[model samples]
Structures are given as C-alpha cells and as structure tokens.
Target chain A: MAEAENKQVIFKQYIEGVPKETDMEIKVSKTELKAPKGSGAILVKNLYLSCDPYMRGRMRDFRGSYIPPFVPGQVIEGFGVSEVVHSDNPNFKPRELITGLTGWEEYSLIQKTEQLRKIQQDGIPLSYHVGLLGMPGFTAYAGLYEVCSPCKDEYVFISAASGAVGQLVGQLAKLHGCYVVGSAGSNQKVDLLKNMLGFDEAFNYKEELDLDAVLKRYFPQGIDIYFDNVGGDMLDAALLNMRIHGRIAVCGMVSQQNLSDAKGIHNLFNLITRRVKMQGFLQSDHLDLYPRFLEDVTGYYKQGKIVYVEDMNEGLESAPAAFIGLFSGKNVGKQVIRVARE
Target chain B: MAEAENKQVIFKQYIEGVPKETDMEIKVSKTELKAPKGSGAILVKNLYLSCDPYMRGRMRDFRGSYIPPFVPGQVIEGFGVSEVVHSDNPNFKPRELITGLTGWEEYSLIQKTEQLRKIQQDGIPLSYHVGLLGMPGFTAYAGLYEVCSPCKDEYVFISAASGAVGQLVGQLAKLHGCYVVGSAGSNQKVDLLKNMLGFDEAFNYKEELDLDAVLKRYFPQGIDIYFDNVGGDMLDAALLNMRIHGRIAVCGMVSQQNLSDAKGIHNLFNLITRRVKMQGFLQSDHLDLYPRFLEDVTGYYKQGKIVYVEDMNEGLESAPAAFIGLFSGKNVGKQVIRVARE
Candidate 1:
C-alpha cells in the first residue's frame, strides 16, 4: 500500500474541571498498513464514533481508573464502527465491516483481531453498534435485569432520563411491567421521556426545587428500583423515597463530575433501615452476557418494542463539544458523531 | 395477683447532636398484666442491654430511620437478654432465658412472643447473647463473607477498629488468611487492634492529619476489602486506596452521626473506574444465616480462635452514658451495660 494516512483526534492535556474544546485537537498523521511486514494487525477506516460520558473519566490523570488516561497528542480511543481496509491477521479480511475499540478520527491500526467483532447484520445503520445495540444499550439491560431486578408493578426511577443509558433503561422498565418515572434537566428531554420513551411520568429536575418532594408527589408508594446516572442530591433524595428492599443500580455519577465541591448525601442511613441494596457495576464486568444482550435488545428493536434516539454531531471536530455537553445536560438521547457514512 | 410494677427508661425529648444524660429519664410505673383473659402475652425481667450505635439514629426525629424513635415518657426498647417472669403465651415459659427486642429497663411486658427466640445454650454467659455471640458478631461475619468476599491473600481494611462490628471483622479477616489493617480514634484502641485483635497494622486516625496519606502508607498493595464502620473522610480516603474490583461493606457511618455538616465524598467516581462494589447492609437482613452464625462463632470462641472485648458499665443508670460514648469513640470494643448480670 503506497503511503497510507490516518486522521485522528488527540488529547492535548489532562482536563482540569469541565472539559473545554481546547483540551482536544484533531490532526492527520501518516501510517503503514503492512504493520512492519512481520506483525499481525488489521488496519481499519473508521465510520462512526461513540461520544460517551465515561470517556471524560479517562481524560483525568487519576490512578486506579477503569481505563488509563488518553495519552496526550495521541488518537483518543473508544468504541467505533469501522471497515477493515487491510489485514495481516488471518481472522480479519479486507473490506469487512467490524465494530471494536477504535480512534475518534478517520482510521486506526488495531493489532488484536480478536477484539474486533464482525458485524453480523448488514443494511441497518452501522452506528447502532455504538448506541442502542452496543455498550449503552447493554448497560441499561444488564443494570436493569441483572442489577436492579425489578418486579412487575414495581416503581422504577431513572435519573438523566433522556441520556443514552437512562433512555433505554426507562423503556426496558416499562416493558418489564413497571411503573417508570424519570428525571431530566430539560423540558424537551422530559417530554421525550413521557411521550416518546413510554415513561409513566417525567419531570425536569431543574424546575423541581425539592427532589424529595417531587419523588413523593410522583411515586407515593416509593421507588422500588433506581437506575442512578446523575448521583448527588438526587441520590440523597431517592434514598428517602426508596421502599423496603429497594434496589439501586449505580451506573454513573455525572452530576458530581465537574463540581469543585461534591454534594453531601445525608439520607444514607436509610440504606440500612429500609434494607436497600445499592450496587455499582460496569458493562465490561458482565461481558460474558454480551451475546445474550445483543439478541434481546436487537430483538426488542426489530419487534418495535424499543426505540433509541441519538443526538448526532456532523464531524470529528464536533466530538469535543458533544462530549462536554454531557456534563451540562446538553445532548438528547445517545450522543454520537457521524465521522463517516457508509 | 397483686398489681405489678414496671421500671423503664424514657426519652425526655428529641436529642440534639450527641445525647446527654438529661435527654433520658428512668421512671417506675404500675400496670396489671391482664390481656382480657384470652390474650397471649409475656412479662419479662430484663437481664442484659445492648448499646448500639444505630440507636443514636433513633435519638433524632429522622423520618426514615431503621428503628422508630423513643417516645417521650415511654420505655426505650432495644435488643436485650431477658428471663420470662410471667407467661400467658404457649411458646414462652416462665423462667426461660430469651433474647429479643426488649425495653431498656428492669422489666417489660412483651406482647409479641413469636418475635422472641428462647436461648437454648445454658453454659454461656447470657450477656454474650447481646454482643460477641449476638447481632454484632453476625453483622461482621455476614457483611464480610457475603458482601466483601475477601480472597485468601487479599488486603482488608476496617475502620472504627476496636468497635463492636469492626473488632469482629478484623478477627474474621485474619482467620481467612487476609492481611488486615484498622483505624481507631485513640492510641489504646489502636494498640489493642494490633496486639489483641491480630490486625496486621493499626493507626489512630485522629492523630493523622491526612487520611488518604495514612491509607496509602499502610495499604501499599491497595485494599481489597474495606469494612466501613466510619464514613466521611475515611470512606473517601478508602475509595482512593481501593484496588481494582475492591469490595466495600458499609456497616455504619458513625463518624458523621453527630455532625450537622457531614463531609461529601469526592472519590465516588472510583466506584465506576475501579469497578468497586460498595454495599450497605443490616444484620437483620441476614437473619436466615443466624443459626449458622451462632454455630461458627461459638466454635471459634470455644476453640480459642476468636476473642471478644467488651467495655461494660455497671447498672442501668450508666447505659445512656455508655451509648453516648459510642458516638464520641470513648468506649472500646462492644460497649454494653451490665444491668443485673446473671
């Protein structure tokens, strides 16, 4: 292959607080497709990129994080849809549509072919691999069914209701014969939750001054399951409203990320009194159930039982702003960047 | 029968912050134990009283507490060892030694005989039913084995090291071939943790200016299991020092009990990053394991594999002060009051 090249988004510095646009920069670099002749690797041309809130955690220079910090001036890596341009590895063939951990920019050279899963179904939007049919959807399914363990007629509450994971969690709870209520930061998101997402009730947490009172008004019988995304005062309030033997699936804590001073939770004593079970989990930990997750969620989508919405940015340059939007609750549904179209 | 007299301890008012002697008053009242001739009931002479930290939560008028608040001018009830003096119930016989929820007084008329368990072991000290061989022991055992699930060579950390639950957890971890470190408020307690309790290391948290630094210095390999008795800064520090896939068994948050302003934990994001599992549980939730708990702990004590320490106060009058000392970290090991010990 004559003089191949790759376009990539690079981390410039460790984020201090709320990520700024300047923290990331897009640049193009030249690379070899042959992987130095002897090495076994596959070169991929990136198609779709996933903009997830968890990536913000990797931007910080903290020890003991789930994943390591993105190296400065290097391609920022996350789950992406790509087409294999060339392969030295026997498993991967040229022109194969694949999904795996890839760069934020145009192309990537993935050495490990095992990590790249071949896209089984074609003609559907390949970007769905990054959203509904991928990590976020699996997160919602696993956290709800496996962690929360909601029973029929149980009250389910999801915070950050219109976000990627929360949106799917609410819909799944509704499908599970649960009474679902969600809290969002915007009126549009609240409308989407109640009207589009099939939540029984939705409220704009920004408009509601007292979260505890709002929860009481909506869920008089108390919350049976809480899919916690935005942890802070909301978590504290939900603790008070949890029923006996309530289950809280702690997926994320986006609300406390950028704050210089974290919110203090006073109602934690209720965990013991009410016999509440709160568990924190990562989708990666439960990877053994991935095949089942794909079948269940894809089946739900095909049957028109589930709908996934995404806020798509146009290019790689917009990826930084799209990610920063996660902290301020700017995006609706799953945020994605259409790096390239098939 | 002549009119019977009942001696009881009653709350004078809702306690503010740490409880004072003035907050509670002991009084004697007379009542006939007549249950309309057909009612099943039993009158008991209280033997040993259990002074627990969770009772401090009930002292306040908190709405969502595990146990109900002590009513003004009424008996303060808790788990106690008692002997039935009069029985109108078929299950309970007069002179039977029993353990159940009872009043903090000389005598009580218990209507719920089914909730009470008759003590079968005759040779063991009856007071041991309130501490070492009772709820506290079971709490430490279940919380550690079930929640923490420490590996054979894992590093375990326990806060409030010399307290009731913490003391037992340290010994249990040691028995499991895990390296255990503990924190206490005083040097005396710290020494006891290292010397008597078989902790690998112990520290006085009060003397340490930086909790995070203290944890880092001790747990160089990182903590695999953290038995959290004290929350706030210590909990935050433990979060930072936890190894990947660490388990935090949150048994109590005694540090933040009296403070009007509790510290906000900043390192909770570590839960997602490190894939840590932090869970809070009550001893009663694991009641099914009580029989197994009794057998295991009894064997450990009899075989000289486990030793329990108690700081006992003489008479019922000192019970309130003994409980108050718990919040201030004044009492060592299991704080109990010997109210007419057999």
Candidate 2:
C-alpha cells in the first residue's frame, strides 16, 4: 500500500446564523490510499467537489432534518466526482470514474458505495457528474415536471434563476414550451439567464424592493408555476400573484438558510384563494426517474436544446469560501471545486 | 301572481376587519311570490341558511378570489335549503324542496337554477341539508380523503375541531383508522371533540399560550395529516410538528379572514425537511365525489357510526349576529340560521 498526503477540508463546529469561511479549515493528513482486503470498500482520489445549498443544513447541530448534521473535527462530506485507485468491492474496478457521497479530501475510502454510480464517459464533462448530471440537475427535472406539472404556454417563474437548480428549471420549462421568467441576485446572472440561458425574461431581484409588484409586472395574468429556490420575501410575493390552481415547487430556501429563524410568509392565504398546491421534495425520493432523466437530459444537451453553466473554483482550499458564498449569492451557476484534473 | 312582504338581511357596505352585526340591516320589502312566465327561474321560500367561514372572503371587495365578493346594499347570499313556491323551469316544480345558493330573504326569485339540487326527504332532518350534507360537509370529505390522503394508523390533527367542516374531518379520519386529535378555542368544544366527536385526544388552543408545546403534548409522534381550517398561529405550529411525508389540507383561514393582512408563517422550512405536502382545495372542485360522499356519510349517520352537531339560531333576525359570531369563535358547532320549519 502506498502512503500519501491527503489534503482535506475539516468541519470546525456546529454553525449558527450565516456560515463563515472560518467555520471550515484546510488540513493535510496521511492516508494509505488502499482499500482493506474483503472490506467491500473502494479507495478513490477525489476529482471535483460540489458546493450545494442543502449542505448548509448539515452544518447546523440538528438531527431532525432529512440528512444528519456534520460532526465537529471531521472531514466535511459532500457529493464529489472521483477516480477509483483500489477496490475490495467486486462491483467497482480500478481507474473507474464514479460519483456519489464522498469526503472533501484528495482521497477517500468509501465503505458505503450503494448510492454510487459509474460514469459512462459519453463525451460530457466529467465534472458534470456533480453538477448538470448530478443532484441539482435531477432536482430541477423532478421539481419542474413532477411537482410543478408545467403545461405549454403556461407562465412560469423561478427564483435563484442562474444558480444550479433554478437555471436548469428555467431551461427545462422553456423547452417544455412554457413562458419562463427568472429572478437572480446580480445583473450579470440576470443577463446570463435572459441571453445565455434563453429565458423569456430575467430580472435582478436585488434591485427590486417590492417583489410582488415585479412579479405582477412580469406576469400580468399571474404565474401558473413557481419554482421557488430562495424562500423568503420572494415566496410570499409569488404566492400573492399565483394564478388559479397554480403549483409551487419549494426546492430550497437559500435566502433564509443563513438566518437563525426563517422569515415568515404572510400570503399563504393566496394558497386557498388560488387553490394552489405547494409541495417540498428531495431528488433522492425521485430516484426512479434518474435513468429517464439522464437519457432525456443527455439527448437535449447533445442536440443543443439545453445548456449547463458551472462556476468552477480551483483547489481544495477554495472549497470553504465557495460553499459560504452560496448564502450571499456570489456564485453565478453550479459552484464546483476542482480538486484534481483527469 | 301573489304579493308578499319579503323580510331580508341586506349587506350595508363592504367590510374591513372583523365583521359586525352593523354591517347588515334587516329590510322588509314587497315581492311578487311568483316566477315570470317563459323565464327559466324558480321562486323559493328560504328555510335553513348556513353560516360559513369562507363567506368572510366574499365580504372583501376582491375579484381575484375563486368566488366573487358580495355587492353592498344588496341581500346577503349563502347556501340554504328552500321550498319552491312557483317555477317557470320544467325541471323544478312547485312545493319541491331544494338546496343551493339562495338569498337571505323570506322569498327569493332565483333566475340561475343551474347549481340547485332537489332534496330527497329520507327521514333525515331538513336543516341537516344545510349543515351536515352541504358545502361544509363536502369540504371535510374532499379535504380529508383526497387532499390529506390519510393512511391507516396515521396521526391526524384538526383545527376548529368542533366546527362544521372540522367536526366531519375528525370523524372521517377516525373512521379511516387514524389516531385523531383536535384543537378548539374553548374547553367545551374540546370536550365535545374527545367525547361527542370521537377524537382520540382534544386540546383548547385558547388556553395554551405556547401552541408548539401543546401540539407536542397532544401529538408526540408528530402529525401525519393536518386539516387546517383556522390558519395563523396554529398553522405555523402544525408546520413545525409535521412528520416526514405529512400532508396539510388548507381548507380555510378563519383566523386570517378577520385581518386585512394575513399573519405570516415562519416555520415553513420544516416542509422541506419533513417532505410535507401542503395543498389548498375547495369542495366545489371535488363535486365528482359528492355522490359518494352523500352515500358514505348517509350510511355512517344511519348506522350510528357518525353524528352531527349544530348551533342553530332562531330566525333570519338573528342571521347578522350569527354570521358575525363565527369570527369570534362564539358558535360551538355548525352555525345555521333557521328561517322557517316544515
């Protein structure tokens, strides 16, 4: 077994309020770089690390959430693309590319590989296994189609529009023949949404103080489907402007995730007035659609019907700032850390 | 044609804040108690008029709601049981009993008779048609069975548990083998929920200062289905105590209807963590189930498996006060105004 220095990002302690870059620290540790014999584990070198908003939920000392909180003084765990170095599991082979839950380190010994999927190497970017083809992409697919149940020419609104999930949701709604409008934090992201992503309309949410008036201006007839990523004032505004029998797919609450307590939504009465259906879903629950999602999304990407954007940061040391930047809306697209090149 | 003095309750003006008895006035005017020849209209004598919480929405001058608001200086309209005095329409004959939308007057000339249904005298009390077998009862059926999707042994919670819709919702959940708990504004209503309504447990929300703690005390395992009738603080409390994959049926917002601006719900992030589905539905949308509802509920009542409770007022003179009392939680059960008897 060859011993090597494994560079890692470690969780400092349970977080409160907004996460700071100091909450995580970079460290170097010795690793065997080998899987134990008959241990059914695979040792892999991490390639690309994903920074997702849902990861923030893991930083708090709350056991009641879908995923458990990160332990203090441990390697931070997240979705990552990796290349296998050694394997005791018969199913996985050496040099095979895979993606699933992995530690934020240069190398990791994964004992639980049930959720892992082997990369097909179909000319798509390998880093996309953690972005466009990963949880965020799948979240967009499930939330829009299954939860929102979009119809052709129906008015659609999305928050966090240029980010990982919202960007994909907007593109998919456009491809579905929906009149898609998106709101993003920065003017650059807003420009990207309107021009680059082919959204019907885009606006900088940071510039709008009254979201209700802005939503009404964009959708005079009222929004038929709202893909809510940043839940706060925007969610309340969207509720007031929903058309009859509207559907709201509550994907994430990026804006409220930083606060110790979430902001209150005053317009839920609109749910009854509009006869709306507001549902919260996780991509993991809709794993049955993964195969179909991969096939459809891959075909669309190849035919240039859909596009993906990534805000890639260099090295493991940048992982903390990149993850923390999510709360402040700093990243434009799928935020990923490049740990190693293929 | 015969002439009669029509005693009516006229809505004085569009209301703001909680409704008051002064918002309506008793008016006596002459009316021709006969339908015009060649006109497809029916003349009816109003019998039992139902006072519903949703009627408050009609008081506000808002056109975006599912139903249009009430026109001031006109007769207040509501669901009522009536007897046909004269008819020009072939479908309806004189001396026939019916249940549908009618004015709060001694005699009403209903021009649009499309929604009217002839009531069958099956040894059941005629007032029950406006209480247990009317819109409120149907709301309970559709909201509980269709929206909540209650499973056997699941925990169920109902707000305003002794009210028209909530009483029926609690009973139906109990029949479905769920462990039911209900919250009311008074100890008497709580006693009615536990003993008379057959709920497994009941609590007085007015007595409990901390709604979250009270909910935890009642529903230790967390609620699987919450029939939210009075949305505000209790709804926020229910959101925090929901189990994984819980369903919340947004039936009405009696608490919010009083306020010009609705109260904000702060714990909506739990919807994502618990994977909860919160849906708003109207009973009219589920009318296809009405036939089945009539059959099932009628059988339950006949077999002594279900019971209905009513808070009946003496006459149309008490209609204004009875309707206004709903906002203050003064009525214990289904609030109905008995205008005349068979």
Candidate 3:
C-alpha cells in the first residue's frame, strides 16, 4: 500500500439561498492509495467531475428530498469519470477506467460498485462519459422518449436549451423530426443552438418581456411537447401556449432552487383546458434504458447527427466555482471539472 | 305547427369574477314547437338541466378555452334531459326521450342533432340521465381509470369530495380496492362522505386551516392518487404530500374559476422530487369509454355497490340561482334544475 496527499473540495455548511464559492473549502488530506482488505471497495483516481443543477438541492438542509443533503464538513460527492487504482471487488480491476459516483478529490474509496460501469477507452473522449454519454444525456433520452413521447413534426419547446440536458433534448427531438425551439439566457448560446446544434429556432429569453406572447410568436400552432429545465415564469408561460394533449417533461427547476419560497405557477388552469400531461422524472429511475441510450446517442455522435458542447474547467480546485456557475447560466454548456489527465 | 310561450334563461353579460343570480335573466319568448322541414333538426321540450361547475367558464369571454363562451342576451346552453316534440331528423323520432345539449328554455329547436342521443325509458328516473349517468359521472370514470390508473390498496385522496365528480371518483376508487379519503367544505358533506358514501376517511377542509397538515394527518404514508376538483391552496398542499410516483388527475378547478387571476401553486417543485404525474383531461375526448362507464356504473348502482346524490331545483327559473350557488359550494351533490317531469 502507498500513502499520498488527496486534494478535496469540502461542503462547509448547508445553504439557504444561492450557492457561492465561500460555502466550500479546499483542503489536502493524507490517504492510503488502496482499498481496505476484504472491504469489497475499489479506490479510483477521479479524471473529470460533472457539475449539475441538481447538486444545488443537496446543499440544503432538507431531508424530504429524493436524495439526501450533503453533510457539513464532508467531501462533496458527484458524478465523475475515474480510473481504478486498487480493487478488492471482483468486478473492478486496477488501471481500468470507470464512470459513476465518485468524489470531488484525487481518489475515492467506492463501496457502491453496483452503480459503477467499466468504460471502454475507444476513440470517444473519456470526458464525455460524464457529459454526453452519462447521466445528463440519459436524462434527455428518457425524458424526450418516455415522458414527452415525441411524434414526427410535432412542436417542441425547451427552456435552458443550451444547458447539458436541454441541448441533448433539442438535438434528439430534432433527430426525431420535431420542429424544435429553445430558450437560452444569452445570445451566444442562441446562435450556437440554431447554427451549430441545428435547433429549428432559438431565442434569448432574458430579452423577452412577455414570455407568453414570445412563445405564441415562436410556436404559432402551440407547443406539443415542453422539456422544462428551468421552472418559474417560463413554465407558466409555456402552460398557456400548450396544444391539446401536450406533454411537459419536468426535468430540473434550477430557477427555483435559489428562492426560499419558489415562485408560484399561475397558469396551471391551462393544463385542464389543454388536456396536458406534466410529469417529473429522474435518469436513475430509468437506468434499465441505459444500454439503449448509449447505443442510440453514441450512434448519433459517430455519424455526426449530434454534437455535444462542454465548458471544461481545469484542476480540482475549480470544482466549487464550476458547480456554482450552473445556477447563473454562466457555463455555456455541460460544466465539467478536469481533475487529472490519463 | 303549434305556438307557445318559451320560458328561457338569458345570459345577461360576460362575467369577470364569481357569477351572480343577476348575471342571468328569465325571459318569455314566442316559439313554434316544431322542427322546420329540411333543417334535419329536432324540437325538444326541456326536462332536466344540469348546473355544473364548468359552466362558470362559459360566463367568461375567453375564446382560448376548449368550449366557447356563452353569448350575452341569448339562451344559456347546457346538458339536459328532454322529450322530442317534433323531429325532421331520421335519427330521432317524435315523442322519444333524449339527453344531450339543449337550451335553458321550455322549447328548444336543436340544429346540431349529431350530439343528441335517444334515451330508453328504463325503470330509472329520467333526471338521472342529466346526473349520475351523465357528464359528471363519465368524468369521474375516465379520470379515475385513465388518468389516475388506480391500483388495489393504493392510498387515494379526493378534494371537493361531496360534489358530483368527486363523489363518484371516491366511489369508483373504493370499488377498485383503494383506500379512499375525501375532503369537503362543510362538516355535513364530510358526514355524508364517511357514513353515506362509504369513504375510508373524510375531513372538512374549512375546519382545518392548514390543508397540508390535514392531508399529512389523513394520509400518513402519502397519497398515491389525488383526484383534484378544487385547485387552489388545497392543490398546492396536495403537491407536498404526494408519494413517489403519485398520479394527480386534474378534473376541474372549481376554486379558480371564480377568480379573474387564479391563485398560484407554490409547491409544484414537489412534482420533480416525487416524480409525480399530473394530467388534465376532458371526458368528451374519451367518449369511447362512455358505453363501458354506463354499463359498469349502472351495474354498480343496481348491485348496491354505489350510490348517487342529487340536489334538485324546481322549474327553469331556478336554474340561474342553482348555477350561481356552485361557486359558494352551496349544492351538496350533483346540482340539477328540474324544468319538467316526464
């Protein structure tokens, strides 16, 4: 066994409002670079860490949520692309690349090997395992296919359209022959959505005064499917412009996560008049479709039918800032922290 | 052709807030009680007129809704049980009993005969055609079976449980072997729900100021199915107490119909955390299930497995007050105006 210094980002305390870099502290601790004997654990050195909006929920002190809150003074845990260094578990071996739940540090002693999957180092970038081929991509797939049930030529609208999940969702819907429209916070993201990602149309929602009128203008016939990543006034606006039997996939509520009392949705009555179906889902719950998601998304990428955008932050020290940047729409696309090179 | 004075209820004007008795005026007009030749129409003598909560929506001058608004200074149109006095349409013969769309008047010359259906003079009361076996009943059937998709022994909750749709929904959920709980505005309605309607538990929402606490008390394990007829604070509260993968059937927003601006729902974020599915539907869209509903419900009534309650108002002149009373939760069950007898 070898001993080493592990650099980590620690959750300093539970937060109330929007997260800031001050809420986390960077520390260096000594650790044995080996899994304990007969512990059924595997130690892995993290390569890349994913920054997701759902992580904001873990910063709160609420116990009623689906995932437990991050404990004060503990190393912040998140999804990451890692390489195995030591293993006591039979399924994982030393030097094998894997992706699943890891740490915001140099190395993690993972006891939950069930969630980890062995990553084949093909031509595809290993960093994509935490972005396009990971949880966010699978989320887009399950939500668009299972929740929205997209039909050919149907009108689809997505908010936070340039974000990790929304970008993938728009591309998938486009590939499915839907007339896709997306709303982003900046004009740069909007330009990328239309020119680079091939969305039918894109708009900067920050410049729009009346979202309802804006939606009506973009979707003259009304939206048949709405992939909602930002839930607030945008959700209320989308509600009023839904076509009959429309489906809304409630993916993430990044806009409401900061407010102590979330903004009230006033136009839900439209849900009845339009006969809409609004459902919330998680990617973990639909892991049974993971194999299919990997096949379809990878196929699309290889054929150049789909393209992924990542905002890579170099070094483990950038983890807290990268995670915090997701709430403000500061990250242009999928936010990832590069911990170490292969 | 025969001449007669047709007593009719005229919509005074478009309403902004809650409906008032003065919003409608009773007028007597001359009429020829015969279907004109080549008109393919039927002249019917009105019997029973249903006063539904959804009728309030028609009082507003909104064209975006599924149904059109009521024309001011004209006869109010609604579902009714009638007798064909004269018929030029081959589908309906003279002197046959029927139920369908009809005017709030003594004699109605219905031009759209496509929506009309001839009724059999079964041993059941003719008024039941506008009530337990009519739109409200079918709404409960479709929302329960199709939207909620109840499973045996699942915890079910119904808001506005003493009203027409809620009462039937509670009964059907009970018949499906679900644990049913209902909430009503008055203690009397709660008594009726528990003792007469055979609900597992019943509560008076007015008595409990904290709706979320009351729901938590009644549904300790959280509600699996929520049949929501009232969509205000109760709906917001129900969102907080839903179980994982809960289904919420949005039947009618009786609570919101009266307001110019509906109250905002603040707890919709729970939809994501719980992975709940909330759907809005119209019974008219599921007419294919009507025959099945009629068979099942009629059989349940005959077998003493279900019961229906009606609050009947005598004469066509009473229609205005009965319809207005719905906003105040005045009617105890299915509200009906008995225009005439068979």
**What TM-score, computed on C-alpha atoms, does each candidate reach?**
0.94, 0.99, 0.99
Worst 10 residues of 1 chain B by lDDT: B30-39
Relative to the true structure, candidate 3 reaches a TM of: 0.99
lDDT of 2 at B158: 97
RMSD of 3: 1.0
Overlapping backbone residue pairs in candidate 1 total 1
Better-scoring candidate (TM-score), 1 or 3: 3
Q: What is the C-alpha lDDT of each candidate?
A: 0.84, 0.93, 0.93
- What DockQ was computed for model 1? 0.53
C-alpha RMSD of candidate 1: 2.4
Q: How close to the true structure is residue A65 of candidate 2, measured as C-alpha lDDT?
A: 84
lDDT of 1 by residue, A1-342 (tens): 755656778899887678887888878888766544556878888888998888887887875566788888788889989898888788878888898798887778887667778996643568889899889988998899888888999999999988989999999889989999999999999999988989999999999889999999999999999999988889989988999889888888888777645766767656666777777789888889999988888888888898888998888878889888888989998998888777
* DockQ versus reference, model 3: 0.86
Sort the predicted structures by DockQ, highest score first.
Answer: 3, 2, 1
Instruction: List runs of model 2 lying over 4 Å from the truth.
Output: none
